[model samples]
Target: MPEPHQLAADADRAAVVTRLDESLADGRLTLAEYEDRSTRAHGARTYGELAELTTDLPRPAAPATPAAPGPSPVARAVYGGAWHGAWGNDLRAAWTSWLVTGVIVTGIWLVSMLGSGDLVYPWPVWVVGPWGVVLLARTLGERRSRGDRQLPA
Candidate 1:
Protein backbone atom coordinates (compact mmCIF):
# COMPACT_ATOMS: atom_id res chain seq x y z
CA MET A 1 0.00 0.00 0.00
CA PRO A 2 1.14 3.52 -0.68
CA GLU A 3 2.15 5.67 2.27
CA PRO A 4 -0.56 7.93 3.70
CA HIS A 5 1.49 10.98 2.85
CA GLN A 6 1.42 10.09 -0.86
CA LEU A 7 -0.25 12.61 -3.14
CA ALA A 8 -3.95 12.04 -3.61
CA ALA A 9 -5.49 11.80 -7.08
CA ASP A 10 -8.80 13.41 -8.03
CA ALA A 11 -10.49 10.01 -7.76
CA ASP A 12 -9.13 9.63 -4.23
CA ARG A 13 -10.59 13.00 -3.23
CA ALA A 14 -13.89 12.17 -4.94
CA ALA A 15 -14.10 8.88 -3.05
CA VAL A 16 -13.70 10.70 0.28
CA VAL A 17 -16.38 13.19 -0.79
CA THR A 18 -18.73 10.30 -1.58
CA ARG A 19 -18.13 8.80 1.88
CA LEU A 20 -18.90 12.16 3.49
CA ASP A 21 -22.12 12.34 1.47
CA GLU A 22 -23.12 8.90 2.69
CA SER A 23 -22.37 9.86 6.27
CA LEU A 24 -24.58 12.91 5.89
CA ALA A 25 -27.40 10.83 4.42
CA ASP A 26 -27.19 8.33 7.30
CA GLY A 27 -27.42 11.19 9.85
CA ARG A 28 -23.99 10.46 11.20
CA LEU A 29 -22.92 13.95 10.24
CA THR A 30 -24.86 17.17 10.66
CA LEU A 31 -25.12 19.40 7.61
CA ALA A 32 -22.50 21.72 9.00
CA GLU A 33 -20.11 18.83 9.66
CA TYR A 34 -20.78 17.37 6.22
CA GLU A 35 -20.12 20.66 4.51
CA ASP A 36 -16.87 21.12 6.39
CA ARG A 37 -15.68 17.59 5.68
CA SER A 38 -16.75 17.67 2.06
CA THR A 39 -14.89 20.92 1.46
CA ARG A 40 -11.81 19.50 3.17
CA ALA A 41 -12.09 16.28 1.17
CA HIS A 42 -12.17 18.16 -2.10
CA GLY A 43 -9.18 20.29 -1.19
CA ALA A 44 -7.12 17.45 0.29
CA ARG A 45 -3.68 17.15 -1.28
CA THR A 46 -2.50 13.84 0.25
CA TYR A 47 -3.98 10.50 1.21
CA GLY A 48 -3.53 11.25 4.89
CA GLU A 49 -5.48 14.50 4.61
CA LEU A 50 -8.36 12.80 2.83
CA ALA A 51 -8.39 9.88 5.26
CA GLU A 52 -8.67 12.25 8.24
CA LEU A 53 -12.04 13.56 7.00
CA THR A 54 -13.71 10.15 7.34
CA THR A 55 -11.80 8.56 10.20
CA ASP A 56 -14.80 8.93 12.53
CA LEU A 57 -17.17 7.10 10.19
CA PRO A 58 -17.78 3.39 10.45
CA ARG A 59 -16.51 1.17 7.69
CA PRO A 60 -19.03 -0.44 5.36
CA ALA A 61 -20.04 -3.95 6.37
CA ALA A 62 -18.78 -6.84 4.29
CA PRO A 63 -21.38 -9.27 2.97
CA ALA A 64 -21.71 -12.39 5.13
CA THR A 65 -21.24 -14.54 2.08
CA PRO A 66 -19.57 -13.39 -1.07
CA ALA A 67 -22.34 -12.16 -3.35
CA ALA A 68 -23.21 -14.98 -5.74
CA PRO A 69 -21.38 -14.29 -8.99
CA GLY A 70 -24.43 -14.25 -11.20
CA PRO A 71 -27.51 -12.32 -12.26
CA SER A 72 -29.57 -10.60 -9.55
CA PRO A 73 -32.42 -12.56 -7.93
CA VAL A 74 -35.15 -10.56 -9.70
CA ALA A 75 -33.59 -11.19 -13.11
CA ARG A 76 -33.14 -14.89 -12.38
CA ALA A 77 -36.74 -15.30 -11.20
CA VAL A 78 -38.37 -13.27 -13.97
CA TYR A 79 -36.13 -13.97 -16.96
CA GLY A 80 -34.86 -17.43 -16.06
CA GLY A 81 -31.37 -15.93 -15.88
CA ALA A 82 -31.32 -15.07 -19.59
CA TRP A 83 -31.42 -11.34 -18.86
CA HIS A 84 -29.09 -9.50 -16.50
CA GLY A 85 -26.87 -6.47 -16.03
CA ALA A 86 -27.29 -3.31 -18.13
CA TRP A 87 -28.27 -5.04 -21.36
CA GLY A 88 -30.90 -7.07 -19.51
CA ASN A 89 -32.45 -3.89 -18.14
CA ASP A 90 -32.71 -2.54 -21.69
CA LEU A 91 -34.33 -5.79 -22.82
CA ARG A 92 -36.92 -5.53 -20.05
CA ALA A 93 -37.84 -1.95 -21.04
CA ALA A 94 -38.15 -2.99 -24.69
CA TRP A 95 -40.42 -5.88 -23.77
CA THR A 96 -42.57 -3.63 -21.62
CA SER A 97 -43.05 -1.22 -24.54
CA TRP A 98 -43.85 -4.12 -26.84
CA LEU A 99 -46.48 -5.47 -24.44
CA VAL A 100 -48.11 -2.07 -24.05
CA THR A 101 -48.15 -1.51 -27.82
CA GLY A 102 -49.60 -4.97 -28.41
CA VAL A 103 -52.39 -4.30 -25.93
CA ILE A 104 -53.29 -0.97 -27.52
CA VAL A 105 -53.28 -2.33 -31.05
CA THR A 106 -55.26 -5.41 -30.06
CA GLY A 107 -57.82 -3.23 -28.30
CA ILE A 108 -58.26 -1.10 -31.41
CA TRP A 109 -58.71 -4.23 -33.53
CA LEU A 110 -61.34 -5.57 -31.12
CA VAL A 111 -63.25 -2.26 -31.14
CA SER A 112 -63.19 -2.04 -34.95
CA MET A 113 -64.44 -5.63 -35.29
CA LEU A 114 -67.34 -4.88 -32.94
CA GLY A 115 -68.31 -1.79 -34.98
CA SER A 116 -68.26 -3.75 -38.28
CA GLY A 117 -70.44 -6.54 -36.75
CA ASP A 118 -68.20 -9.07 -38.52
CA LEU A 119 -65.00 -10.98 -37.72
CA VAL A 120 -61.97 -9.15 -39.06
CA TYR A 121 -58.56 -10.74 -39.63
CA PRO A 122 -56.42 -10.02 -36.54
CA TRP A 123 -53.84 -7.54 -37.77
CA PRO A 124 -52.22 -6.72 -34.43
CA VAL A 125 -50.31 -10.01 -34.67
CA TRP A 126 -48.33 -8.52 -37.53
CA VAL A 127 -47.24 -5.64 -35.29
CA VAL A 128 -46.45 -7.83 -32.28
CA GLY A 129 -45.04 -10.99 -33.84
CA PRO A 130 -41.87 -9.87 -35.60
CA TRP A 131 -40.87 -7.66 -32.69
CA GLY A 132 -41.40 -10.58 -30.31
CA VAL A 133 -39.26 -12.90 -32.46
CA VAL A 134 -36.40 -10.42 -32.50
CA LEU A 135 -36.60 -9.92 -28.72
CA LEU A 136 -36.64 -13.69 -28.15
CA ALA A 137 -33.61 -14.12 -30.37
CA ARG A 138 -31.73 -11.46 -28.41
CA THR A 139 -32.65 -13.09 -25.10
CA LEU A 140 -31.53 -16.50 -26.29
CA GLY A 141 -28.29 -15.02 -27.53
CA GLU A 142 -27.66 -13.45 -24.11
CA ARG A 143 -28.34 -16.78 -22.39
CA ARG A 144 -25.99 -18.61 -24.75
CA SER A 145 -23.22 -16.09 -24.19
CA ARG A 146 -23.60 -16.35 -20.41
CA GLY A 147 -23.41 -20.13 -20.66
CA ASP A 148 -20.26 -19.95 -22.76
CA ARG A 149 -18.43 -18.02 -20.02
CA GLN A 150 -19.00 -20.73 -17.40
CA LEU A 151 -16.15 -23.07 -16.57
CA PRO A 152 -16.78 -26.81 -17.10
CA ALA A 153 -17.45 -28.53 -13.79
Candidate 2:
Protein backbone atom coordinates (compact mmCIF):
# COMPACT_ATOMS: atom_id res chain seq x y z
CA MET A 1 0.00 0.00 0.00
CA PRO A 2 2.89 2.34 -0.53
CA GLU A 3 2.58 5.53 -2.60
CA PRO A 4 1.86 5.43 -6.31
CA HIS A 5 5.47 6.03 -7.23
CA GLN A 6 6.73 3.55 -4.66
CA LEU A 7 4.38 0.94 -5.97
CA ALA A 8 5.37 1.81 -9.53
CA ALA A 9 9.09 2.20 -8.87
CA ASP A 10 9.14 -1.26 -7.42
CA ALA A 11 5.68 -1.78 -8.84
CA ASP A 12 6.21 -5.46 -8.67
CA ARG A 13 5.91 -5.79 -4.88
CA ALA A 14 6.58 -9.45 -5.46
CA ALA A 15 9.96 -8.57 -6.90
CA VAL A 16 11.27 -7.04 -3.68
CA VAL A 17 10.18 -10.13 -1.78
CA THR A 18 11.90 -12.33 -4.34
CA ARG A 19 15.06 -10.26 -4.09
CA LEU A 20 14.96 -10.47 -0.31
CA ASP A 21 14.55 -14.20 -0.49
CA GLU A 22 17.45 -14.45 -2.91
CA SER A 23 19.62 -12.25 -0.74
CA LEU A 24 18.83 -14.27 2.36
CA ALA A 25 19.58 -17.55 0.60
CA ASP A 26 22.96 -16.20 -0.51
CA GLY A 27 23.71 -15.05 3.03
CA ARG A 28 23.63 -11.45 1.85
CA LEU A 29 20.96 -10.84 4.53
CA THR A 30 20.37 -12.68 7.79
CA LEU A 31 17.03 -13.89 9.08
CA ALA A 32 16.86 -11.03 11.58
CA GLU A 33 17.70 -8.48 8.91
CA TYR A 34 15.18 -9.97 6.52
CA GLU A 35 12.44 -9.85 9.14
CA ASP A 36 13.18 -6.22 9.97
CA ARG A 37 13.16 -5.08 6.36
CA SER A 38 10.13 -7.17 5.55
CA THR A 39 8.19 -5.70 8.44
CA ARG A 40 9.04 -2.19 7.41
CA ALA A 41 8.24 -2.84 3.79
CA HIS A 42 4.88 -4.27 4.69
CA GLY A 43 4.04 -1.71 7.38
CA ALA A 44 4.77 1.28 5.18
CA ARG A 45 1.69 2.68 3.47
CA THR A 46 3.32 5.63 1.78
CA TYR A 47 6.65 6.87 0.48
CA GLY A 48 7.04 8.88 3.68
CA GLU A 49 5.93 6.11 6.02
CA LEU A 50 9.51 4.91 5.64
CA ALA A 51 10.57 5.97 9.11
CA GLU A 52 8.47 3.52 11.08
CA LEU A 53 8.59 0.96 8.34
CA THR A 54 12.34 0.74 8.79
CA THR A 55 12.63 1.69 12.44
CA ASP A 56 14.06 -1.72 13.34
CA LEU A 57 16.21 -2.12 10.25
CA PRO A 58 19.90 -2.59 11.04
CA ARG A 59 21.97 0.47 10.34
CA PRO A 60 23.34 0.40 6.85
CA ALA A 61 26.33 2.17 5.32
CA ALA A 62 23.73 4.70 4.23
CA PRO A 63 20.07 4.98 5.11
CA ALA A 64 17.92 3.13 2.64
CA THR A 65 15.15 5.66 3.28
CA PRO A 66 14.67 9.04 4.88
CA ALA A 67 11.89 11.12 6.43
CA ALA A 68 10.01 13.94 4.83
CA PRO A 69 11.03 17.46 5.87
CA GLY A 70 7.58 17.81 7.43
CA PRO A 71 5.22 20.80 7.89
CA SER A 72 6.21 24.45 7.75
CA PRO A 73 5.98 27.01 10.56
CA VAL A 74 2.54 28.30 9.69
CA ALA A 75 1.21 24.76 9.35
CA ARG A 76 2.59 23.70 12.70
CA ALA A 77 1.39 26.81 14.51
CA VAL A 78 -2.20 26.22 13.51
CA TYR A 79 -2.29 22.43 13.78
CA GLY A 80 -0.98 22.16 17.36
CA GLY A 81 2.07 20.36 15.92
CA ALA A 82 0.36 17.01 15.72
CA TRP A 83 1.52 16.02 12.25
CA HIS A 84 5.04 15.00 13.21
CA GLY A 85 7.42 12.46 14.78
CA ALA A 86 8.26 8.90 13.69
CA TRP A 87 6.12 7.05 16.23
CA GLY A 88 4.83 9.04 19.23
CA ASN A 89 7.42 11.79 19.12
CA ASP A 90 4.83 14.37 18.20
CA LEU A 91 2.58 13.41 21.11
CA ARG A 92 5.41 13.52 23.61
CA ALA A 93 6.62 16.85 22.30
CA ALA A 94 3.10 18.25 22.52
CA TRP A 95 2.88 17.19 26.16
CA THR A 96 6.22 18.81 26.88
CA SER A 97 4.93 21.99 25.32
CA TRP A 98 1.83 21.79 27.47
CA LEU A 99 3.98 21.52 30.57
CA VAL A 100 6.07 24.55 29.65
CA THR A 101 3.01 26.47 28.62
CA GLY A 102 1.32 25.57 31.88
CA VAL A 103 4.17 27.23 33.78
CA ILE A 104 4.01 30.29 31.57
CA VAL A 105 0.26 30.40 31.99
CA THR A 106 0.51 30.19 35.75
CA GLY A 107 2.99 33.01 35.71
CA ILE A 108 0.65 35.06 33.56
CA TRP A 109 -2.15 34.50 36.05
CA LEU A 110 0.04 35.42 39.00
CA VAL A 111 1.33 38.53 37.27
CA SER A 112 -2.11 39.64 36.14
CA MET A 113 -3.42 39.16 39.65
CA LEU A 114 -0.49 41.05 41.20
CA GLY A 115 -0.43 43.97 38.72
CA SER A 116 -4.08 44.78 38.22
CA GLY A 117 -7.41 44.29 40.07
CA ASP A 118 -6.80 41.23 42.25
CA LEU A 119 -7.93 38.13 40.27
CA VAL A 120 -10.39 40.08 38.09
CA TYR A 121 -12.73 38.65 35.51
CA PRO A 122 -11.82 41.04 32.67
CA TRP A 123 -8.36 39.48 32.49
CA PRO A 124 -9.08 35.83 33.17
CA VAL A 125 -6.67 32.92 33.72
CA TRP A 126 -9.00 30.67 31.78
CA VAL A 127 -8.44 32.69 28.61
CA VAL A 128 -4.69 33.05 29.07
CA GLY A 129 -4.03 29.53 30.30
CA PRO A 130 -5.70 27.79 27.37
CA TRP A 131 -4.20 30.17 24.85
CA GLY A 132 -0.72 29.73 26.27
CA VAL A 133 -1.09 25.97 26.23
CA VAL A 134 -2.23 25.98 22.60
CA LEU A 135 0.57 28.25 21.50
CA LEU A 136 3.17 26.18 23.32
CA ALA A 137 1.87 22.97 21.87
CA ARG A 138 2.02 24.38 18.35
CA THR A 139 5.48 25.86 18.74
CA LEU A 140 6.97 22.74 20.28
CA GLY A 141 5.29 20.53 17.73
CA GLU A 142 6.98 22.44 14.89
CA ARG A 143 10.36 22.38 16.61
CA ARG A 144 10.07 18.66 17.31
CA SER A 145 8.97 17.96 13.74
CA ARG A 146 12.11 19.71 12.54
CA GLY A 147 14.17 17.51 14.88
CA ASP A 148 15.33 20.47 16.90
CA ARG A 149 15.13 18.35 20.05
CA GLN A 150 18.19 16.52 18.77
CA LEU A 151 20.34 19.60 19.26
CA PRO A 152 23.35 19.24 21.57
CA ALA A 153 23.22 20.84 24.97
Computed on alpha carbons, the lDDT of every model, listed in order, comes to: 0.83, 0.57
Candidate 1, residues 50-125, lDDT tens digits: the string is 8889888999767698554665577766766665533536677778999999999999999999999999999999
Which pairs clash in the backbone of model 1? Answer: none
lDDT by residue (1-153, candidate 2, tens digit) is 555445323434344555566667778778998887666666555555444433343434553675656556654567544555445355546566667766776677778878996655544456456766776666565666765443211
Please give the lDDT score at residue 100 for candidate 2.
79
Error of 2 at 142 (Å): 20
